[model samples]
Target: MDMKKYRSTMKRILGCISRYQWGVAASLACAFVTVILTLYVPILTGRAIDCIAGAGAVDFPRMWKILKQIGIITAITAASQWLMSHINHWVTYRVVKDIRTQAFNKLEILPLKYIDSHSHGDMINRIIADIDQFSDGLLMGFTQLFTGVLTILGTLVFMFSMNPAITIVVVLVTPVSLFAAGFIARRTYRMFKMQSQTRGELTSLVEEMLGNQKVVKAFRHEADAQEQFENINEELRIWSLKATFFSSITNPATRFVNSLVYASVGIAGAIASINGLLSVGQLASFLSYANQYTKPFNEISGVVTELQNALASAARVFELIDAKPQVPEDPDAAVLNNARGEVSLEHVYFSYNPEVPLIEDMNLKVLPGQRIAIVGPTGCGKSTVINLLMRFYDVTCGSIQVDGTDVRHMTRQSLRTNYGMVLQETWLKSGTIRENIAYGNPEASEEEIILAAKEAHAHGFIRRMPQGYDTVISEDGGNLSQGQKQLLCIARVMLCLPPMLILDEATSSIDTRTEIKIQKAFSKMMEGRTSFIVAHRLSTIREADVILVMRDGHIIEQGTHESLIFQNGFYAQLYNSQFAV
Candidate 1:
């Protein structure tokens, strides 16, 4: 990520802090107090040492006073530190949860193009693994940063009071430690960033391969898959090692600078004590403060290391959050309630990529209650027709209108709710059979659900399940046969009973016998509704009220099936090829 994006990512973290300021403020305040109390202990300990080592015989009374002060400070330090930790944990997790929720909500509004371009595993990694790293590192990182800084500053005040000359050595040497940390940080951040991206690639590979594991096994591509995975994993290992190798350099580098500072302070203090410029007690206390002062550098350097990883992961997560959503919704959008199902495309032009111009200068109109079957070769804009009509991707130029109002005028919810769809690929969440059937109409009663299932011919097999409609379906409905899943999807659409319907190869997975049975059901259900069927099976759509033949981006022929066959154009060629086989 560039500096602009990094700053944007940090602003997001600052936003989290702002949102939960009360909790963070409490944590910061506790951290501040804890460091102050901790600094007091070292000063008190040195006082006791000077009292015993000087002329008096033990100075028992004075020693008791010093010990009591140290004990009180220690107790407060422990309590305050505990409070700071608890608050930090609460704020960290809440921020993480908020971030994940926002990302998911963004997905719902993002353009299909964005989702299509990104890998599923990469998206998942941002939500889960990257967010986890950010939370762990960011929470502790800020806490330590606050304490380390306050500890250094407080110790500096005392050091200067005891000996200004020695304070100069301490102050000057500290920057060497910081400079080393900064140099190492700059190098390690790039390494960690690359490692984070590699981890996402590995995750994407695993998700892709595992999802298609059956295909892999059937083709016996296990060795090739393994080889591919090993390559990605090896790349990840190299980046991870390089990141670790660079981050590891900071601790020793900071410690070494701090060691020099410690030795110089010790020598200067002893010489000052001999010259009577500093008392034994003051010299002891200054040395203690000097040691405490430099300790935070080592601690800060360690925190910085973890922080680099956090920042890298955070940038990835924020990338998703910051991504622009699909085209903005119209401000004064109208609603298409009680839809008449009259849809039209006027002077339409569209392309997945504008330069390619997959569709151009198209116009079409459909009356209510028409069963329109759109047929074409693969990639001939058959499915694209459904996509545009459903407003998944808006037309590049011109407008799509429903009920005489441009689709852009209607709220997508209002426009889409009027139509029901079942696509070539079936999707089912992990839920009960009944829930899957009732997906489009969650309020559908048991009788209504069963009636829809019977219409789609899924009721028979559903009854054979050990738990009937109550049986739970696994993810993607993997537990059921493809035909079973298709039937369930059809049943879902039937339950919705929208004014318009889209069946994009909806029955492709069913056996011919079952398909015929369901066709009969669909024929009856198509009454008084606009239905667009993108069918590959020529025989199945022969009864369509109108057959629209498409090639490239244009409809090459349009008429009833018999008329199209008589015309002997593209539709005739397609129909003859299928029937002759």
Candidate 2:
């Protein structure tokens, strides 16, 4: 519906195609040759038939020469078409490959907020399904589209040369076919666009349901889920049918109009032949040219349908590619090297939405090796603080500095690489346990990986598996228990030996006894390293040098546990509530 987006999408598709323009140019040349051969062969055949019609006597030598020419030209036309098909296919697939690569690379640099806001399954469709449709239509359009146009043009020029009167008849009826094709194409495009979007919705619904099958079964919502899926599936089916119906009408519409043109040319040519204005052989050639011209009208009408489908797919892909990244990294950003773990927030202000300000003019200073614990009720900005600290979302005002330099002045990768993080949500890729642990520091040795695993109490469980450290975990570690997955994630950070660490309810999945043991291990690990601990269980941070008690996005109280308990404020009451049970 947006003309500007349509133009932009077409321009980008053209750009990808132009990468192999030399090949495309060669293919076009082949197609042109094929068109000429097609026109010439028909002329030769018609001339042979006219030799007998005119003389009423067999001109054996002349007829044989004409037949020979026809045979050779037909062979050449077939070869030229083959070349065209080959070149078009090779160039088309390569262009598609480049497009997919660029799209995937764009995702890597895209802002997290964009990924979070967009449906993941819709994105998958753009990457896979939509691109495939675009490729198929593009390839067909490339070869057939150009060939049909040239055939029409070459045939028209020959028709005019032979008989201008019949040429006018051919041109007059051409508009009817064009009009029909254009009308049908417009409606088909709308339907195809709707179909593409509906397909994305269906894919997203499937992904969401499959990912949360546990919740659906636990809530006994099978029938409800099936109904929802059916609703989306039926919507996709309706749009798909409508699009197919509209496109299918095109070939028949063009055929009906073209048949009128074909019939008129035949009747007109016969009259011209009766008179002496056109020779018998020439009139025969003219009829062949008329058939040639009208046939392309049919082929091109079909191509129009394909072109619309391609453009619809291209529009979706270009929209995703053009999405602006979260925040651009500074060209002259500082490189953080061997950071000493000192962090300071100065007059910071932040909010997910500017109208509803959350963290307001906040200030915090952390020493190089201090163990800082941040505690608060749900939605009290506990996680927002970490998000800001990690520069996932920058402070709306003021600055967060690492080691003496503003975090904004450092590259995100360099800044984040220095800190190790373990969250309650454990993420494990499809790889062996050894690979997961060494993900942060790929160069870590086998000995270092084992030591880190042992410290997390994961070494024993991992060794008991059939393949030990080489056991490949399924996607999301579906084969492992929650606690085992959590331990593997912790072991990953332990191997990194980062300059700073953040534990965000990292032990929530483990049993109480195991959590206590891991807590002791973490306490030992924190002897000289700076750590940021976030917990609902205040008991875990009993030995923290400082505890920040947050309420409504501000630190309502700040001190050691004994000091905060003596104050008998929000921190003391919150700590007391836990033991009340």
Candidate 3:
């Protein structure tokens, strides 16, 4: 890990902790008391030892009194430790909650392009798994880190007061443990970071496979998927082992140095006792102080290992929280209200990638209440046009307007609320059928919801459900057939009944008879509303007032269906191919 980055992450971690200033102060005070009381016990023990002047000459009352004091101090120390532990938990979890909330909110405002380009599973891992890891590391830091440092400092002060020469021996030999831990920590951080990244990749792969299980099975790609999973799993395992190996050595290596320090203190103290520089009881106390001083090194080494994992996870989560959001909506933008839907694209240009131009210098105009149909082969910018019209992706150049007002000057919420959309891919949240239909207009009356469902030809199946319209659907309408799910989506749009409409293969999943019925219903609903229909089936758009035949992101032909057929152009060829038999 870069030392600079490590410091930066630590600073951010501290900044998060700074929010609960009172909690931190309370925890520190408890830790200070616990360490101070704990260190004082050894001094009382030394005095108790001195009171036992030989076997029979023991000062029984004095020994008993000292023992009582020791017992009282121990009880208080335990209570302080307990309070500190709880405080640490309170602060650590609150910080985790704040960071996780921030990360989630960032996702909400992120541009669709970022979400489209990244793996869903990886994003979920950063929000969930990485944050959990960070919390664990933070808990450990709050629990042991402060206490361990104080214990070390307190022990050194007590030891130096007892004997300066022995204190120097401990202080001199301590650098070896510090050096060992630091060396291991530096190498382990990079290994742990790689391990975290691999884990995210594995999660993404699993999520993709699970979500498309039907397609995977249809193609019999199970073995290939297993192979890919195994490859990523094996990579995660390797990195985990390497990180664990390096971190695991830290404890034993430090313990070995600590043991050597203990021995050196013992030998030096014994010589001083013999030379009449210290008493036997004082020597015992010095040895106790030496043990106390070195024990923190063992705890701190473990903390170092955990801290590396935590810091690695923190970096990943922070990356997500710090991602740039979509460009801010203008505060003073116009609010499109009851739009007349005179939509137009004026010299528009767009591409998913700047290097690979898809649409360029495109223009079109639609009068209010006109039913315009857009037909094109796949990858011909049909959907891209819809995306720009809805401001899901802004035009790379030029302007799109509604009711003669530049869309860039309109508030997104008001602009989107003016249009009702039904697409080939239907999405329904887990909820009752009534709730799903009312999703766009939550305040819609029950009668209104049922009327919309009936218009979409979905009321029959919805009434047959166990709870009628109140029947709850599983995620993405998993319990419903594809055609049934599409109807519910249509019903949702019908309930909204915006001034403008967009139907992109809206009836593709329904049977022909049902499609015809819904198409008639749609015709009535769109009687005086401007509507854009994108269809591959040429027969469905025959009644469209105008047909825009697009190819390679450019409009190659434009006319009514009859006129296009008379011209015998690309639209005629596309229409004829469907009825070739």
Candidate 4:
């Protein structure tokens, strides 16, 4: 929508293309050769006609030789076109691959809040559809535009040299037609941009529906989902039609203009021949050049339409590529090594949005090897604390320190490497159980993986499966039970053996018996590790060295479990409500 932004994106795209300048040069050379060959065809036809009319003993052998030469030239032209296409494809694909890699790297560095604000479907569309569209544009659009321009220039020079009167008639109509074509192209481009955005929205809607298919079935919301999809689909169709209509108009308008100019050239050439100003061979040659000259305008109009479409796609793709990550580490930040696990949050205040503070003046200290449990009502900043500690979001005020070093002063990789985390929802890629366990510690030996699995109490169950530790799991561990998925996460964390651990509702989904089994494994994993637990079930955190109760962006209470129970405060009330028989 913004012209400045569009210009900036174009600059970036040009810069990317400049990286493969040699390949682009080779492609352009091939396009020029093909155009040159194409222009020679009309001249050759005119020569053959002139020879036939002269009646010079009818040189059939010479005619055959000329025909063979034209055939050879045609074959070479085809080969040149093919080479140009392959080169364009190679360059476009390489640039697109680099763009995708850079986009993903940018995503990795961006803060969690950026991802939270963007939809999964929209991002996926940019990565897949937008990039694919850009590739198409760069490959086909470049070749067509370059060749069309070259063909037009070569034809113009030859036409004027053959006969200026006919050349002028044909040339006079070109600017008006080009101006009309440009206006139509601009309208089509705007429609194309809107169509791309709407398609992304449609893709997002379908993804959401499929992801929540269980919810939709349970609530019998099939009709609602269908209606929502139809709305987006209709909008997409309208935009698509507008783009198609405008693009379709350009070719017909161009052809009509070309027809008018061709008629003018014929009439003017006939007059010159009648006035004895031009010979029959010259008149015929002028008409042939007239057609050749008009061919480029037709080619230009078509290429302009295609380029408009490609440019629209390029603009969308570049918008994402140009987005700056929300969080950036200092260039001089140092990597931490052998970090002591002592963490302190000093008078910290933070918010995802500045208007709504999620955590305010939060102060806490965790001694090395101490296990602290954070209990709170939903949306009471329990998870926000973990986010801040991990530097997923920076504090708006005060500071957080790990081992007396400011977190902001340390490299993000170093800070994260010192801690291990187990989330409420277990996520695993489609791979063998062994691969998932060794994900955090890629260099961990087979013996170490087996030991970690044994420690997490996952060895028995995994061995019972068809492939034992080598059994393949679906992405997100869909093939495994909820309990088994949690165990896999635990084994992954255990393999890392980070000094600091954060267990975020780790047993929230397991049954009572499985919870007990997991809790025992968790206790072993937590030993001598500085750990933070966010739990809704009070019984699970009863043995925590310290418990902090949080509410409405503040710490409401802090004490040991026994002391809090004796005090009969928020923690005690929550415990009585959940644990009472």
Candidate 5:
């Protein structure tokens, strides 16, 4: 990531941490106390050594007091470490939870196009794998990092108090070790970044394969799918291997440097002891402090590696959080109240991609309570109109108005609340049948839910099920037929009772008989409501108040179904083709 982006991400993470500042402060304080106790061990060992060397003349009472102090310090250190661990755990968990909740809430506000441009698997990976990686760093890496610094500082102060010459020798090696660690960490971070990206791709591939297992089996494309997956898997393996290899080298290399420094300190201390430059007890204490100093160097190196990995994950997460939604709402947008369902498209032009306009300067009007049928070839932007109407995407140019109010000036939530939609692909959450029906309005009463189900002709089938309206559905309603799933979606939309409804090929997957039944239910639901229907079956649109025949993003013919057939244009040809089949 660029420096500016990295700084921004750090700011956001720090903001998250600041909310739990009290927990963080407590954890840090405990760590400092633990480090203080750790530093006292060398002092206790030194005094015990002196008492032993002094033979019978040594102060037994002083020795006893030193031992007692050591025992007390050890107990306190254990308690402090325990408290620090728990505090760090609680803080990290809460921070991660808040981040996840914010990400989900932002997702709800983001436009559909933002979701469409991103892979579901990758998004899910950010929420799961990325967040998990961050929590590990926050809980373990941050605690160790702070404690290591405290230990190093405490050891240095005590060592200098004993002898500045020996302290200087130990401090001289610090910068070299730190520089080496920084270099290794930078390289390791690059590898970790690549690893996280590859992992996301791998996740996406695996998710796609599992979600389409049935299609893969039917088409006998198992080998092909496996080959594709192997490519992504191989990339992930390479990245992981590289990251592990580099990260592993850091610890061993730091250990080697530390060993060299310890050897030097041992040689220097031996000379100092022989020359009477240091007491035997002081020499032992100096050596202990040397060991303590080198240990944090090793810890620092390890933490650097961990911090790098976390930074990589954080970068990925921040990318999602920082991304601008495809369609942004105006800051001064107004809330649209109780719409009358009259909609007008004044010279409207739109496209998923601006380079290719799907609807060009198309003007149309639908009076309140009118039922309009839209028919066209597969790529004629039939669904795109629904997308634009719902503001899932904004028009590239021109304007769309609802109830004489410009949609662009209205809050997206309020604008969308005025309409109900039944997509071609129905998605039902894992819940009871009644729960699914009331999904549009969670506060809806049980009676209202049943009434909507009855209107959509879904009540009969639901009643026949083992649990009737209480029958629990699986995710995506796998237990129900396509027609039944469509009916459930219809019932969901009906319960909302929006002023406008859009049914985009909602019955296309059903059989002819089921289609007729669903059409009847839809007819009842659409009464006195502005409705837009997009269907391939001409028979389904014949009763529409107005029929619009679109091709190549333009309305080539439009009129009542009978008038269009009488005109013998594109609409007439479409009718003849469907009836002939």
Candidate 6:
């Protein structure tokens, strides 16, 4: 384990907890009171024992006084412990909540590349599972650790006052416990980290399989998927057991050391009492202090093991919270408003990977209210163009301009707000149809939502639902047909009616009949608006004002559909091939 990284992670964890300064102070005060009073009670009990062992009749009044004091101390200690427990819980959970919130907020501003590269399930595990583990470890630390250390110190002080020799014996044996616990903890930290990572991988694998069970079943790859899952599961099991084994060793090792300390303290106290160096009361107090002193070692050793795991888990959470966010917008960036939809790509170049070019020196210009169609084969940068235009990914070189202003100069939110997009993949949250339709324009009225749905030819099916527009769609529109889900997504964009529109196979899932109806609706929607259509079907874009045929990241043909067909080039061959088959 890198001690420096662990130390850094610990300091950050402390910083998060320190936000609740009042709670920390309160818990500290309670712990101090509880441990002091708890240690003091043993002295009181020893005094009561001395009263009973007196040569004459037992000093009943003195015994009664000591017992009363012990009772009061016990009550106060219990009350302080209760308050401390509540405060610790409050502080620990608040820290957890704060960290979880920061992780989620980081996700929002993170670049698309990060989201595309990382596993969603692993991210979810970090936010949920790892944080919960951190919470458990932190809560244990707050509840046991502070008091344990204080109790140890308090016992040493009391034992020293009673008899220095016995106190020395107890102190001399402590390093053994510390050494044993530290040795095991150092090795366990790495194992726990691997355990957490493997658990995340397992979560990602399970999530992948569950999310695509249909594909697995269709492909008849159940046996293969099962074998893959078992491999990950077996790896997770190994890491978990190894981590658990090493951590478990810490407790027993510390306990054995603690037992030796207790035995030495008992032997030394007996000798001291026999030699007239201590009274019976003092010797009894010494034994009690020894037990109290050594008890914390066992507790702290367990805490140390947990802290190792907590630190490991915290490192992962911190990694996410500290992840580099998307490039910051200019402090004085212009906000695009009421855009006229004149978009231009001036020598724009982009690639998902720097090593392999995807779109190079791509140039295009669209007049306001013109329909531009982009047709290309797979992996030909069609959607990449849309992504660059939407600012989902920035260009590697040159610039894209909207309304004669470079898009990079505009705030992403304002730029995105002005353009409505509907892709082939439909997304619907679990909500009423009306709510999903109004997601883009949340303030839209019921009539407006219905109008957009009707325009997208989705109103008929929606109205037939048990509750019409109020019918709650299941997760991802599981209750609805794929075409219906696509229609809802289309209605969503239609409701926004942005100044600029991008329809990338927007009607792919709909049947041919609904496709034609939706096409008519789209035609009305696109009128007087700048639209970019990315279509694989040649039949869809024959009337486009400008057709840009792209191949290998370059636009090789650009003209009206008739002109491109007349050229008998790549575009003509592509258009004729669809008809030929």
Q: Estimate TM-scores for all models.
A: 0.97, 0.96, 0.97, 0.96, 0.96, 0.98
Measured on C-alpha atoms, candidate 2 has an lDDT of 0.89
- Model 1 RMSD vs true structure: 1.6
Higher-lDDT candidate among 1 and 6? 6
Runs off by more than 4 Å, candidate 2: 51-56, 277-284
Task: Flag clash pairs in model 6.
Answer: none
Q: lDDT for model 1, on a 0 to 1 scale?
A: 0.89
Clashing pairs in 2: none
> What's the lDDT of the predicted structure labeled candidate 4?
0.84
The C-alpha lDDT values of all candidates are 0.89, 0.89, 0.93, 0.84, 0.86, 0.91
The 10-residue segment of model 5 with minimum total lDDT is 1-10
Candidate 5 global TM-score: 0.96
Model 3 pairs whose backbones collide: none
Winner by TM-score between candidate 6 and candidate 5 = 6
lDDT order of candidates, top first: 3, 6, 1, 2, 5, 4
State the lDDT of candidate 1 residue by residue for 244-356, as single tens digits. Answer: 99888988998899889889888998999899887777777887787788888888888888888888998988889889898887888898897998988899999998678
Off by over 4 Å in 3: none
Choose the strongest candidate by lDDT: 3
Residue 388's lDDT within candidate 2 is 87
Model 1: per-residue Cα lDDT at residue 147:
88
Worst 10 residues of 6 by lDDT: 161-170
Question: Tens digits of per-residue lDDT for model 3 on 448-495?
Answer: 999999999999999999999889999899899999999999999989
